[model samples]
Target: MNHALKERIIAQSKQLGIDKIGFTDASSFEHLKDSLEEQKAAGHTTGFEHPVIEERLYPEKIFDQPQSIISIALAYPTKIKEKPDIVRGERRGSFARASWGVDYHNVLRDRMNKLMAFIKEIAEDEAALTFKPMVDTGELIDVAVAQRAGLGFIGKNGLLITEEFGSYVYLGEIITNIPFEPDTPIENQCGTCTKCIDACPTGALLGDGRMNAQLCLSYQTQTRGMMPEAFRPKIRTVIYGCDICQQVCPFNKGKDAHFHAEMEPDPEVVTPLLKPLLTISNKEFKHKFGYLAGSWRGKKPIQRNAIIALGNARQKSALPDLLKVIEEDPRPDIRATAVWSVGEIVGSKGNPELEAFFNTLLTTTEAPEIIDEINKVIKKLH
Candidate 1:
């Protein structure tokens, strides 16, 4: 490994807007793979993670003969500069910090491409500098690559926490055949602080950087269909993702980076009106929110979560909107959630519209799940 070449690469990375650059050998992530397997056996892994754990553990599976991995992180803004106004009839839902700005996949990919281009220029006619760029959706576990590259330590909340940016950073990696000197990993700093754990509405943050993604509200919110009944109240107004743990971390207390302009959040999109989302058209949903990472699951999951948000808030004003969804929304999941919302919002209030819908629904709807939800809500309300 050439020291001057590493310096040149580091200098080039800074010029390309990469907030942090660290290098490590593309060796097997043995411990991480073992932990992942244990989690999978315990049925704790979110299905959204890479299905093949083998590829995640070994970077060679992605690019054969890999010698080094270049890990990069770009810091995103943690604070909302311009929050939108919510009128009397409106309740707004929140998107997570990661989903605040533009989709990070494209943004990180572009940066990795520039780094690769620079490496190729310097390696011209000499170094065997083939590379593979991986973002969030890529097979390699980004946090593992980042940790190996000395970018940051894995926080208890299952996020990479850099000294410079806390956990408010988007990570990506370029695995290359050319060997670069590896940096020493950053030491873990979450000593005895249970703030993130205590702050978690759901007990997802298991000790030693482990998490039960099943109980994680962040995963729960993203999932389509009915979320587990127990988690409904815990979610509150979070329509897309949860940030409770990150919000409470002492390291993240005041670190709000505005490095990348594209990573800046448009407050309106991040905190949208709950009612409009209940019936947002697909075309319109895409038009306004397609660029965001939170919109990845499409309208159904977000809308389903929105209905629950309304119910959790118990907004009497949202009653009519909830009723409309119960009557007209195509998805049984949405209608089912609305059924619960209608009851939860006006619990035993003696409203004719609600009582009548409940009376009629019990008799007409044959779906056991919907009827069960109706019965449960009715019982709770009474």
Candidate 2:
């Protein structure tokens, strides 16, 4: 009901450098619950979503007397200016655009915190302005709130695609008791273009602005366990996240934004050399990649994905490194994945070094699963 407050907030957002801002009522998103149930029933969930579905559908369940939700979008850079130097033996792996620069969660939280403070400062009664800010880890689906807030329409890739930033944007929201005037939602702009769905490497996109999260390469990379063999090749050289769906969307052609300097990626950090990751200490990984959003799962998944990338690239020069992982790595998943990657690198070409290595490994390796993988690699290669 407060038109002036809404306008003031919108104007203040420009000063705050928020790419886009929109407001919507905090009614329950009951329509999405059925679809979410269906996805869960079909075993399509990534298991990373908020476990309680009701809390996700209804903001009021978590926030007291929520009357409106303010959605925000911050454009992130899609391309790096400086490319990492990748020579013959020093091949590098990539982190997706979302992982570029500092973690987006931290960046968005900073902006939202500023905006929340501004709202409280200008409100009729600062003490009465009850608000809850949320980033990616929030119970509410970010894209849903953004879509309803008129920031952008949901693309077939299940990403918010604004006219200005396309899908290269980070989303955040604040649930509040203020009864602000809501904005009109944007209509889906993706009419006949199935580029994102067609280009999905793992067929995760289901054509209706929804995705099978379990099959998504992005989800697979984040998973801590050994990646299924089927998804390994599809991951390619991406250690942290997958950008195929966003990259292929027609709206994203040459869509790069530099609104936030903190979101700009460092080439060496984002596209790190693959071999060093095999033996990177926890301390070294934290020092190098702890700040990025992709580092949330820690070094194990990234290390596993790096090994898979080496195998997919058939980086024969990385054979010794992969072998070293099998020999000394503490985690069984890391060791097993390296063994599979070693097989991909060595192939049918008889490597007596690999033959001798596996023959020696069979006796010393205690884990039955790892020993089985080593035997399989030896049989296949030699």
Number of the top TM-score candidate: 2
Candidate RMSDs in order:
1.5, 1.3
Give the true-structure RMSD of model 2: 1.3
List candidate 2 stretches off by more than 4 Å: none
Tens digits of per-residue lDDT for model 2, 305-378 = 99999999999899878878887778888899999998988788888977887888887878867887788888
All candidates: TM-score:
0.96, 0.97
Computed on alpha carbons, the lDDT of every model, listed in order, comes to 0.86, 0.91
- What clash pairs does model 2 have? none
Once model 2 is optimally superposed onto the true structure by TM-score, how far is the C-alpha of residue 24 displaced, in angstroms? 0.4
